[model samples]
Target: MRLRDHVVVVTGASGGIGRATAEAFAREGCAVVLAARREEALEATARECGKHRGARTLVVPTDTTDAEAVEHLARRAVEEFGGIHVWVNNAAVNAFGRFEDVPLEDFRRVLDVNVMGYVHGARAALRVMREQGRGTLIDVSSVVGAVTQPYSHPYGMSKHAVQALGSSLRQQLYVEGVKGIHVCTVMPATIDTPHFQNAANFTGRKVVAMPPVYSPERVARAVVKLVRHPRREVVVGPAGRALVRQSRTAPAVAERVMARQTEKTHLSRKEEAPATHGAVHVPIAGEGSVHGGWGGRRRTGMRRAAVAAALAGAAVAAGRRTGRGAPGC
Candidate 1:
């Protein structure tokens, strides 16, 4: 569990949470392997990681959807670093639109990258980890996986599948009596990452993360912690935790609230963006960064107020129901 000199492979290392996580591991003195479809970006991330003394890095341009490519990525990590201690599956894509409005091909592409990509990475990592007798596999899911959202049906569906996939893998591992191999899922709230901009758009409006956006570094920190302390799942950010709690406690209310909030704030009609498939089928060329420039827009007060109002409303409703059943006193 100690990270110093440990070999870690991180998929989707070119940008967003993946890039920040690679840097985090490097700071822990781990030999990091950066995997993504963007060779130049991956190399850039590798250079950043190399800045840390005693930390080595390998850049592997990989399309996770390709089973062979993912396998090769794993082999290269073992061949270079001698072994893999932690594998992080963070590669994913999204399409924005109503379920019917989104093209079928685009929807399939989302599944291929978000769901199948994680599967391929897990399979390859498990093969190496089982041989090594100890390794941690981390899959980056989302709060949407637990609670549904509007205008992002494919993404939500894929994340749900990711949660199920991790659970199933863990169960099988337990049955096989596999020791030292751990599967963990990290579900984050709306993160201030390039995802909104990179996602394929069909809504015509500019996409934006909802209020109370958490920095990608927050999720990156969580991922690094999981390296040493593996758990079944970890939800990043207070907003995400609140949403998950609400979903579990009041499914109908949560769904209705989320539907309204998503439609109102998730997309902006002021700005215009043309529809594009994004990186679903091809690599986006750039040396991506960790932050998505939404820091100034974070509405922490608004988020806190919303949570308080919801709690108060729930309490009032419960009081009303109790009063209705109580006899005159």
Candidate 2:
């Protein structure tokens, strides 16, 4: 689809994939509406968007957890721009801890933003889209949504909910014969984002992005592609695709490898971290960006990630060889 003059709304525009996606739409000459809790960070994103020729952005400071605020965000986008051609429900938060150890409030907070935030955005955007007779709703889910992870209990659950949200919405739209409204989900693997550093960490160990971390721009490219040709779901990175495929074919091996990975590489073994609610209840101001800069010996780390990936691959290969997962390859 030609998207040069499309109007796009992107939540969580303060940083990470959301910021990258917003900038991408701006580059496409789309009127981008930036929404997040941090006004300063939103302004920063707006400035970056404005750098592109024909890029116009509106900074709407919105806490996606707030239903009313999200509604206002959609209205603002419609008011400033002509209409909402695409809405990116990308706002999210994470809490790192065992299912029981993590505080109940933090868990709920994660759901409020990650799941319910999409609910609000979908409702508001769909209302406008139904009226306009065309629009796209993009939900940013995770690879963990397809394959579960340890310690990030709430995060995994919330992403699973996001995946469900998109599916259910699409089915309902079909039932209602809503021809022009489209709901799509984007599942990205670990990327170079600040989510790891800002998560509510209670594991007493520093959280890391592990390895095989692609740049946020990679995910941005995926989102932009979706705008051109909407799909039911899109997995961004090769590792993410492998994990999803492994989980489907060799479920047992996928679970074992994922548990081992989250237990080992996902958290720092030597560095001690204090228990704190990182960004669950508050926003990190003046420090938001597209990249997290949480780098280790990435080449070595990726070698380790490659090993884990090979394990998953080997399991699938073994399953095919043994005729366990399927009749044949």
Top-lDDT candidate index:
2
Which pairs of residues have clashing backbones in candidate 2? none
lDDT of each: 0.90, 0.90
lDDT of 2 by residue, 218-322 (tens): 799899898788999999877889999999999999999999999989999999899989889899868489989854235436767888999999999887778
Any idea what lDDT model 1 has? Answer: 0.90
Candidate 1: TM-score? 0.89
lDDT of 1 by residue, 1-329 (tens): 56897999999999999999999999999999999999888988988999998899999889998999999999999999999999999999999988888999999999999999999999999999988899999999999999989899999999999999999999999999988899999999999888888888898888988867887888988999987788999999887899899999999988998898898889985888788887777777788877788772255456668889999999999999999899683
Q: TM-scores for all candidates?
A: 0.89, 0.89
| Model 1 spans > 4 angstroms off | 296-329
